[model samples]
Target: TYITFPIYSGITFNNISSYVGIQAGIAASGKRDNTITTSINGIASSENQLGNLSILLPDFGIRAGLILKLSNKLNLHAKYYQGLINIFDKETSLSDFTWRTQQFTVGIRFSIRNTNDCGTCPAWRT
Candidate 1:
């Protein structure tokens, strides 16, 4: 999941718009199943553990993305994120790890305020 704060918007051409923003969010890794087998004096035993094979946990990251407005309500978005905190638990592993991600999405936006209302319009709305 993520949240974005658009800081700027520009009219690239007639009926075309571009936006830039900062995003922050949390991400998680998929769970995995691992097994270990041991043998002693011709006897064998097996053990299984079901969970993440790595040390990744719920992680926080910052992101930046570009939104290309296809229409008044439709846009294409692409973003890159870098982890702000290492997801690796020191107690679990000795290696340092970080989580990073990239996203591409298409979405729709709605505005409650009228476009013609300029009383409280942001500078990017010009």
Candidate 2:
């Protein structure tokens, strides 16, 4: 689950806009049990009953996206998110873990009543 709050947006073209935002969310993973075996300093060792080898939950991230207006009331969007904090628990020897996500969306938006006429096509503002 996640929630996004758009901080800023601007028109890049006649019907296209770019936006930056902050997102807060939680990530959950199921549980599993396994065993791992390795040799340290030429000594063989084996560990059994290993579990909970997933990233930590309740994470936060930043999001950025582009919005392309398909029609007066409809738009298409592409977004990307990257987690700020490492969600990896200290269950393994490996480090450097983070969450990354991408999204494509189609939605509707309503504009206020105005009489200003900008007679331009979709790519004109560029």
Candidate 3:
């Protein structure tokens, strides 16, 4: 499990908007379930479970995406995330290889009211 905080900036061109951002996160907990099987003198087999995995706590990533305004109250968005740090904390035979995260997400957003149509609001005045 992990939690992340993202900072994003967006610009709209006509009906489409583009965004780019950076994110930082931490892995709160990490675990793995493993099954180990062994044979003693080829007589019998035994099984055991290995638990808990060591994970690098800090995560850093970059995000870029686009949003299409389908309507005044609806929008479609897609984003790509690339992790800059390796989350794998284990050492292996291959010292030059590391694990990173790559993800692509697509979703829709709905708004009760379009903010652009609100004009000036008395409640928002400082």
Instruction: Give the number of the best model, judged by lDDT.
Output: 3
Ranking by lDDT: 3, 2, 1
lDDT of 2 by residue, 39-84 (tens): 9899988787746656666566677778887666556777776667
Which scores better on lDDT, 1 or 2? 2
Instruction: Tell me the TM-score of model 3.
Output: 0.79
Would you estimate the TM-scores of all the predictions? 0.48, 0.49, 0.79
Error of 3 at 32 (Å): 2.0
**Cand. 3 Cα-lDDT:** 0.82
Q: In candidate 1, what are the lDDT values of residues 1-126, reduced to their tens digit? A: 333333443445555555454544443345667788999999999999887645444555554555565554455665555556655566675666644544555555554554446656685454
lDDT of each: 0.55, 0.62, 0.82
lDDT tens readout by residue for model 3, 65-123:
99999898899999998999988776633355587878899999999777677666565
RMSD values, in order shown: 6.8, 9.9, 3.1
